[model samples]
Target: MVEPNFSSGRAAERPDAAVGSAPLAEPAAGAAIDPSKEPEGRKETKHLSRSRLIWRRYWRSAGGKIGLVGLAVILLLALIGPSLALWDYWVVDDNAFLSMPSGDHWFGTNQGGFDVFAMTVEGLRKSLVIGFAVAAIVEILAALIGASAAYFGKKVGMVLQWITDLLLVVPSFLIIAIISQHTAGSKSSTWLLIILLAAFSWMISARVIRAMTLSLVNLDYVTAAKFMSVPSLVVIVKHVIPNVASYLIIDFTLGVVGAIMSETTLSFFGFGVQKPETSLGTLLGDGMASATTSPWIFLFPAGVLVVLLLCVNFVGDALRDAIDPSSKSGGAA
Candidate 1:
C-alpha cells in the first residue's frame, strides 16, 4: 500500500498479462441471444422416437385432428348408444311398427317394430368389431408373409409369392361369397367371415410389404443383424417390421374400410351376417326393400356407413401424410 503496488497494478492492466485468459464482454443492453441460432456445437439436441414424431406431426394437421375426433365420436356412439336406447333391438313392439323418430324411438321403428336406434347401435358395434378384426388379421398375415418372403428370398419366397399371386388372380369376391354362404347360418359366422375376408385381403398388402422389405434386407442394420447370426424371424419382427410400420398402419386402416364394405356388400346380397345376428350390412339390406316408402330405414344406416368410411379414409390419409417425410401436408417436426 505504501508504494500503491504500482508494479502489480501495471501487470494487471497489461492487455495480454493473462495470456489466453480474457474477460468475456457483456452483451449490449436488451440484446437477447437466441439459443436456436447457436452454433452446431452449442445447440441443444432433441431426440424423439419415431412414433412420437408421427403423432406430433399428425396432431398438428387439421385433417388429422378432425378425423381423430370423428372416429372417436363414432366409436363412442357404437359402444354406448345401445345402453342409452329406450327399446331392445330384438324385442318387437307391434304398437311402434313403422314409427317415425320420436322421443321414445330416437331413430324411429323398423317394419318389424324393433327400435331402429337400438338396431343401428348394435349393428355399428358388430361392424366395428368385424372391421377391426379383419384388418388386424390381414395386417398380421401381410407382415408375416411379406417379411418372410423378402427375408428368405429363395424357394420359400417363391412359394409365398406364388400363393400371393394365385390369390390375387382368383376372384376374391366370388370365393368369399361362396364360403360365407355356407357359414352364414353357423353360430360363429361372424368369426368365419372375418377369417375369409382377412385371407383374401392380405395379398396386395403383402406384395407392397415384400417390396419394402426387399430394400430393408440389404440395409446396414439388417446386414449387421445377419452378421450377428440373429434369427431370421427375430430380425423380421424387431427390425424389418418397424421400418415399414407406417405403410402397415395405412394399409390396416384401409383394410378396415374394405372389410366393412365387403361385409356390407355380402350382406346386401344375402351372403353375409344372416338374421338373428345383425350387422350394418343386414340393416342396410333390410332397409333397401322399402327405402322409398320408409326413407329413415335406409337413410340412417347408409348415412352412418358413409360417415364411418369417410372418417376411416381421412384418418388413413392423414396418417400416411404424417409418416411420409416427403409429404407437404406433414409440416414440420
Candidate 2:
C-alpha cells in the first residue's frame, strides 16, 4: 500500500490545517518482475532441444561414422547374403561352383563344383553360430568359476587361477591341433572339437570375472547383503552379474573372433568340420591347393572371412571402448 499526505483542500474543507496534497508516484520503466510478483496464469518460456538428434553429432565424427557404417553394412551382408544364395552352393559338386563370378553364378565354382559365393554365405552363418555359442559358454562358465574362486579365496583360487593361466598361455592353434587331430575319430568329431575348444577357452573370461568379483566382494553393498543373510547365489546374481555384464559382453565378442580363428586353423589343418561339412577354412584349404590355378576358390572365401573378422573385431574394439573403464574416455562416441 502507498501512503500520501493529503493536507490541502480536502483537509481545509474538513476544518483541518490547510497544507498540500502529494500525487502518487509511478513505478520506474523496464524494471524486472520478481518471481514472487508474477501472476499464477503466466508461464515462463523455455528453450527447445535441437531437432533430428540421432545423426547430428554422429555425422561430424569421421572415425566413428566410418566404423559404425562399416559395421552395419558388413552385418547386413553377413546376415542376408547367405540366405539369398542363388543356388545351393554349400555342398557337393555343382556346375555353378565351377562357374566364374558372373550374373548366373556370382562367385565362380570350385574344382569339385561348389559355388564359392554360396559357400561363403553359408560359411559366414556357420562361423557366426559357432562363435556366438563358444562366446556364451566361455563367458558364463568362466564367470561362474572365476567368481566362486575369487569369493572363496586362498588355495582354491590360486590353483584354479594357475590352471587358467596355463591354458591362457598355450597357443590356441597348438592346443586345437593336438586335440582335434587326436580326437578326429570320435563319434561326433566337430562337436567334440567345439567342446574341447570351449573347455580350454574359458581362461580369459575367468580372469576378467575374477578381477571384477574381487572388487565386488569388498563393496559395501555386498557387505550389507551378506549382513542381511541373503542367499549367496541370489546376492551374486543380483549384485555381481550386473556389474560384470559389460565386461562379459566385450569379452564375448572377442571370444567369438577367437573361436572363428580357432575353428579355421583346425579346419585348415584338416582336423575340423571334416570332409562332408565345409567351413570357410575348409574351403580356403581346398582353394589353397588349387590357388595357383583356381584363385577364385581361395580369393572369395578368404576375402569374406577376412571382411567378417575385420568387421567383428572393429565392432568388438568399439564395444570394448564403450564399456571398459580404461578405454571409455576414448570410447566410440
All candidates' TM-scores? 0.86, 0.73
lDDT of all the models against the reference?
A: 0.89, 0.73
Which residue ranges in model 2 land beyond 4 Å of their true spot?
Answer: 1-68, 71-75, 90-97, 169-175, 178-188, 324-333
lDDT of 1 at 37: 73
Q: Model 2 over residues 1-333: C-alpha lDDT tens digits?
A: 887656454554555434464533446798776886678677575543422222343344455456667767756777888667776754665444456677766787877777778777777666766777778888888888888777766887999888888887778767667677766655576677778778878987788789878988878998899899999778777887778887787788789889999888778879776665667878888889878787888898898888777767766666555454355334233
Candidate 1, residue 264: CA error in Å?
0.7
TM-score of 2: 0.73
Per-residue lDDT, model 1, residue 114, is: 92
Q: Indicate the worst ten consecutive residues by lDDT in candidate 2.
A: 49-58
Give the per-residue lDDT of model 1 (tens digit) for 247-329: 99999899989999998988888888988889999999999988999889988989999999989998999999989999989
lDDT (C-alpha) at residue 131 in model 1: 96
Pairs of residues at least 3 apart in sequence or in different chains that clash in candidate 2: 94-113, 97-109, 97-110, 97-114, 97-115, 98-109, 99-108
